[model samples]
Target: MMTAASSSGTAPFGLSVLDNALTGIGTSASEAYREVIALAQLADRRGFQRYWMSEHHAMPGASTSSPQMMLARLTGETQRIRLGAGGIMLPNHSPLLIAEQFGMLSALAPGRIDLGVGRAPGTDQATAAALRRRHDHDDRFPEQIGELVGFLEDDFPEGHPYRAVHAVPGPWQAEQNRVPHTEGLPELWTLGSSTYSAHLAARLGRPYAFALQFGRADVTSALRIYRDAFRPSPALAKPRVMVSVSVAAHDDPEEARRQTSSTAMAMLRMFQRKPYALLSPEEVAAYPATLDERRVLDMYMANTLHGTGSEVGVALERLHEQTSADEIMLVTGGHSREIQTSSVELVADHFGLPVGA
Candidate 1:
């Protein structure tokens, strides 16, 4: 049987910003940022609680090179939905800088901001080196994460000399009073694709969000670890978990697949470094494929929850029932603008969720 919290109700569903992966369909980054803006607006209307952007640097496939800048931009465009990074790769910068940047964002957006952290570079090795200068080491992540948590919290205790330092400027200018350095500090979630993250999040008494879109095999194991090791915090009296799933919304399965082709191809190319393009309906119909490509296609199609509007609804409810996820964080790779805008609305309506006017 699922845990009590899992069976009680469907938790708030949210969105993850993959940016250009939706706009270019396979082409470029120029339109991707705009597509993200549009999705953020739609998600707010659709009652999705939060929108997260993953920190991916120098990855030609993703447009979110800077989640903080995107968060600030979204805060101006969106009114209610929480804005945060799916994760900030912790080892890339000092804990103090992250504290200040997020602190400033929380100050600006108030109650609608969140901070989800992860240890991986969120990119390739070369890309990590470009971001971290000489400290391109993998083992430093755990230490960096500890320091990051320390920098965000105010009371560092008397013996912790490092706590005396203010991450954001001075006391007079810090405006700790205005920023609720304590209360205004956004809700924190640990994004993990494995059991290690689940254990850490549980030990830390914070929520854990699974990146199931890529780590499909490890989802169950990770969830089990989190539940077993969970310790309650003031923020959470019980363990809270979120699963990230791929979504492709449409009334027809064939139509949805056609719409998702370039997206699938783009993801494949990200791994294979092959050339791809945004295919037209006829092109999608005419597109050729190899057995290996077809296998990749099968994996993508199986993992993604896509189909007719009602079909998606049933699948989402089932996913929630089986996993008891506190929230469903939907990640869609829209090959065009139309899908980008309509998909979230389609999901919301099918679930009987209110779309704000």
Candidate 2:
């Protein structure tokens, strides 16, 4: 498969943000989502390339589980920036559903929709079973991807069962006065943390986004695999990559550490199957952490973007140099909304992204 040509429009580097919509210790889910919308709006104004949300299920700390619904909601409120799921867990739902959802979103927002798909279920086995209702669909991911893109473009080949199925609100024509987007369908990307996914995205020739935020895989090697294996497709002529990283940006290193503690703790707890709302900085400070607990936390947080804005900018620059990533999407949040918003503003400002719109 082929990919579209290089999409570097103007900027030397692309900056984006990922919001987990963490439920602060004292805040309710409703309030937390409201804060997520605010954060998305801020990123929109700050000129981030895309505002992507992660999908997590059955987690008390993370609220975003329905990326399609969130994309629809954010589309109306946001004016310019692209709104999308960081990577919708493809195995959790039917490709037709995803195609239809994103089709409607593309209709609603026109040029501001992105569809990044991942093979992970984004939840525990029990929760994944509940969502998928079956334990045998994981192997169908590649076929599902083809079905999804086929539905979106109405490009199914003859003898295909889904050939006659037209995704509702399929590609729309631009109004007479409003100029239309040449690439009418939502921008498609393959998201992953390993060379397997990178190779898949490369072979498919679509844009690739590497998830370094929670993944322990070798980012540099994964990206190199993507680029080295890429074959031109109708959708893309050159390989493009996006690398997402965990970020905790603040002026003081100690402050940064404190701010990121809640997230670090939450990650461990989630893995331990003991999810809880985000802890406050005070709670994290006073909580009794055993030596073993402290060691685990340290190991869990060993690879993160923790530093001031300028420092983070330098780190991202080095990453760009190392991976040749076209965009750097910062997955920042956990302790509080203020910290999340500030990190977004800081990264935007440091990157010299267009702001004040």
Q: Which has the greatest lDDT?
A: 2
Find the 10 residues in a row with the least total lDDT in model 2: 1-10
Each prediction's TM-score versus the true structure: 0.86, 0.91
lDDT of 2: 0.80
lDDT per residue for candidate 1 within 1-357, as digits (tens), equals 111111224434433333333435355676777777888888877667778888876655566677888898888999988889888877777778988888788877887888888888766667778786345444666666667666766546678878667666323234655652343677788887888898888988888998877725578888988999998877788988888887778766777776676566656665675533455545545658788977786686677777776686678778776777877877876466666565677777776666588
Tell me the tens digit of each residue's lDDT in model 2 across 131-168. 85466676887888998888788788899998777777
Off by over 4 Å in 2: 1-11, 172-183, 290-292
